[model samples]
Target chain A: MMQETVITNANKAYALLKADADKILKLIQVQMDNLTMPQCPLYEEVLDTHMFGLSREIDFAVRMDLIEVEEGKALLDNLEKQLNLIHEKSQQR
Target chain B: MMQETVITNANKAYALLKADADKILKLIQVQMDNLTMPQCPLYEEVLDTHMFGLSREIDFAVRMDLIEVEEGKALLDNLEKQLNLIHEKSQQR
Candidate 1:
């Protein structure tokens, strides 16, 4: 593909990833709200797994030259930080 | 919480997981459709990472007694089969 097309696809992919990550975070928060057990292993497991997937997807984009490696890593790092905040919020409840 | 409430929550979680899984699959298929390279490592990486995440989520649900172990395994198996089909379709293109 042309350089322009590649850039466009990369931006599109990043946008989709960001949108989905936000949605996933909201879903996890919803689960946490209804959770009776403060130490819900199941909830943690799902969140961890989801984060793992996102990290890999970002890496893949970087490797495909669709996005910069720094960009991908930064995105994952931001998501991880958000995930930790969510966990902390749940723990406070 | 009461057993009834637990059951209700479990059902809701499963429903949400199922819905999200379907959405993810559709998103992946879209990515595959626009892919110029048949052997897109990035695409496969994202898909594999996603499947890994889902399997972990299912395992957590089973362990937490939200769903039966067998049911969790079955769901993962079916997803794997569907994922393989998607991969095959992409390869044929």
Candidate 2:
């Protein structure tokens, strides 16, 4: 598998800029998953805006190589959409 | 404020390497805060081991300068003990 067809063409070029990278990737998946927590200077203002929106979608999917940079592979490819919105909000409870 | 006294000397130089940076900062605060979530390649194997253990405690607190790399100020200086372990596990319920 040639690197999963270049990450399925970088997830179809991140579906044409994944709706502004899913707005800070859904606030970094609701602060990971406690569902909320952003108070002190807004918790460093949302972890410095989700570390600059997931490092600008892993630097534009590694300048179009899609991924493969010393194993990190472009930040696990945007951490698979913050773990699919934390399992679609825990299967809507 | 001279950058909060150099992040309180990088939280006292991360309390002398804050006990191995509080062991991967408490597994990146229990995968943020659901308390636990690690499966499927162990979830990119713990987000690549908490992104190489919080980028090696922000590169040894930015090579001992303690912190301050532009407004990020060295990753909100390790997101303040992952927000005090999610408020001490919500004040122990």
Candidate 3:
């Protein structure tokens, strides 16, 4: 029962982190779709702020032992790759 | 046992948050003690980043139901008060 509870918390942490990453991806997608220049300072600031916030949450989860460090890194990396693809598509337009 | 585990996690979350807040306070204290101008843009940026990071952690904990929303707000508000006090002291110097 104790182990099951721990696993549940870990799963919850992972789901929350993924949801946040997806939100950032969608926000960037909307910005790109609207023709917001990727080079715009405001766009950069918004991305930076969101990324920082998500990273902090991931770090907290890792420190709390609710999520693995590698898991957190992978989540961030996956988001970055998607964002990069969007950036590339925007630049090609 | 399940209830106890949940309480343990919540206690851990609160303790971790308090530690992070204290670290920020110490960092600002050191900066002031070294006569680093609080008005400096770099100082402002550093403080902003740290506060944002801590707030993110607190938000995540609140969302996870590991801490009460009021508890999280109180933690942040208390830190803000201490930081303001430090800023005022620096200004008087």
Candidate 4:
């Protein structure tokens, strides 16, 4: 019964995180959409703020061992790749 | 020479990514540390902003096949776990 309860609670939390992530992504999209050709301070500020929050959450997870360090490292690697691509693309234009 | 160039470039990008992530984490910590009693809207805002950015970057990486979706999924699962724990602790306190 306890195991079942844990599963249900975890599942519920999972749903909430997914929903929260979706909403934030949507918010980003809205910002990106309204982006001027240069996509001003506000756009970058918003993006940086969001990205920073995610990293902190990941950092906390690692510190707490809720997620393996390797996984967090991998996520950082992936984020770095995307960040570089975005930076390069923006610079190229 | 070509392989060396790719390696060097990727390495440089990795360093930048690490630094960027660290700075962002510091910024979040600053916000967190400044929390007065309840840690109001701004604190949550900063945290959520960063988390969402991380998720979106993960999503884009998955779409580009730069990172495996399973890896991204795992990261999300871990984030959800940490969030729940944080929420619970906050509630109990």
Q: Write the per-residue lDDT of candidate 3 for residues A1-93, one digit (tens) a residue.
A: 778878888999899989999999999999999956899987987788889989999999999999999999999999999999999989888
Models ranked on DockQ = 3, 4, 1, 2
Score candidate 3 by DockQ.
0.67
For each candidate, report its DockQ versus the true two-chain complex: 0.10, 0.02, 0.67, 0.13
lDDT of 4 by residue, B8-61 (tens): 534443343344345545565454445533357666766667556666545543
Q: Tell me the alpha-carbon RMSD of every candidate.
A: 17.9, 17.4, 1.6, 15.8
Docking class of 4: incorrect
Highest-scoring model, TM-score: 3
Task: Report how far off residue B52 is in candidate 1 (Å).
Answer: 3.1
Best lDDT among the predictions, by candidate number: 3
Count of clashes in candidate 2: 0
lDDT of 4 by residue, A1-93 (tens): 645644553344334333434554656555444553335766677666755655554554444223456766666566556555555555565
Per-candidate TM-scores read 0.49, 0.23, 0.91, 0.36
Q: What is the TM-score of chain B alone in each candidate?
A: 0.81, 0.30, 0.97, 0.55
Q: Between 2 and 4, whose DockQ is larger?
A: 4
**Candidate 4 regions off by >4 Å?**
A1-93, B1-39
What is the alpha-carbon lDDT of model 1 when measured against the actual structure? 0.66
Q: Which residue segments of model 1 deviate by more than 4 Å? A: A36-38, B1-50, B53-93
